[model samples]
Target: MSGHSRLVELVPLYALDALDPSEAASLESHLEDCEACRAELDVHRNVAAQLVPDEPPAIHVWDRIEAAISQGDEGEVIDFGAERARRRGNPFNWMLATAAVVALVFAGVLVGQRLAFDGLSTDEGVVAAAESAAEEPGALVGDFLVDDVAVARVVLSKDGLGYVIPTDALDTLDPSRTYQLWVLTPDEVAISAGVLGADPGPATFTWKGDIAGFALTREVAGGVVSSAGDVVSVILDT
Candidate 1:
């Protein structure tokens, strides 16, 4: 046989480390001259490595393997004539068995998909879904991040007066640069509330103008004559 075929034939012995030193040396030297032998040897070696399990499994995997060697994966092979006769006797039953397996697999896939789909809609997910829904206006999901980092989601209430709500629990509101709620669109500026600087957790407040007109802004402790800071948050239209 050619060197490549010889390598294939020798592969099981090489994998088992049963090759004699002289034979192994000859094979290694041959590998340098025969590229096909080297390639085939590498493939066989990789297959051997994969046969070793990564960990001690919980179940007895070797039980079936032992049985498989004595009897083939399907069953003990019958004489071809006998096998033909048996197949002829039960062709309809074989088709039914195959169909049942296919139906079971299809049901399992559908159940798995439904479970994944149901899992997507969580309590936390509901708020995002509500906001994204086509009919409803965008909403303010309150700040849950950054401890001691104060956030005020100033929402303009429907009745026109603005509510200055603290997104997080605030520290002592800055006495000097008071947090004043300002209603500002592209045009006019109006003070919703002069900075209380001490309102705890989601406080409601009064508006200087119609909430429908301008977006909201926070200014110094005492309300500002002009815009000082950015529009912290805006109630987006539904």
Candidate 2:
């Protein structure tokens, strides 16, 4: 496999220390520059950490494992069909059972990570996420318009994580006021997505559920729970 693809596949195994030294080193090096892979690794690591139960298994669990090991030691013909049937019937194969559970948990975590924002706090990371979202199949892309003229652009992923990129069309506001982003729902309720600075640049925010559209309003500095200011720009879902 290619470098990135190989590294991504190794992430879950790496979290469990299943990779050899060389493989681990390569994955670590690749993670330094790849934010998305790093995020995936983080998710896998978190799931692995949570796998340890608060209470230890009963003595019967250990007895079952020992019995399975003893049965493996006998020098008998290794028949693949019989082994499969044995494993299916054997309740002592706790290791295989545990592995299956871990696999299911990791699958769920990967799906959730894809839908949930990775919490990219830096400007560069936010821009990268937005650009990545723009390339996604179901991403919503549009322009924020004022008086029929475009003032800003937005790229919202299907999961509702999005970024707003402002243009020179929006003049800088006074120190006492700031640009606030509102996520409008079908009910016309305006939810505050984020507060952009007086001179807006590229910024990220997350909104759940259905979004009817988006709007930028000039509000008091630090923003407000309810907007009581001028609407600067609007972008409706088309």
Candidate with maximal lDDT = 2
TM-score between model 1 and native: 0.28
Worst ten in a row by lDDT for model 1: 99-108
TM-scores, all candidates, are 0.28, 0.47
lDDT per residue as tens, model 1, 1-238: 8666766677567656679967765665566567766667678778888998898764566884565455533433212123333545432222222221110011222222211212122333432332232122331222211232324433333333333444433333322234544332222223244343533333445443332222334455554433333343333221
lDDT of each: 0.39, 0.63
Please identify model 1 stretches exceeding 4 Å from their true place.
1-150, 169-173, 190-192, 198-201, 207-220, 230-238
Leading candidate by TM-score: 2
Where model 2 places Cα greater than 4 Å from the true spot, the runs are 1-125
Clashes of each: 4, 0
Q: Give the TM-score of candidate 2.
A: 0.47
Q: List the residue pairs that clash in candidate 1.
A: 137-238, 177-221, 178-220, 178-221
lDDT (10s digit) by residue, model 2, range 1-238: 7889877998888878799978876876677678988788789879988998789778999996676556545622212233444545531122123211110011222332331233323366666777677667667666665665556667777787888877666666644478988776655455677899777778888866786667677788887555553677565654
Clashes of 1: 4
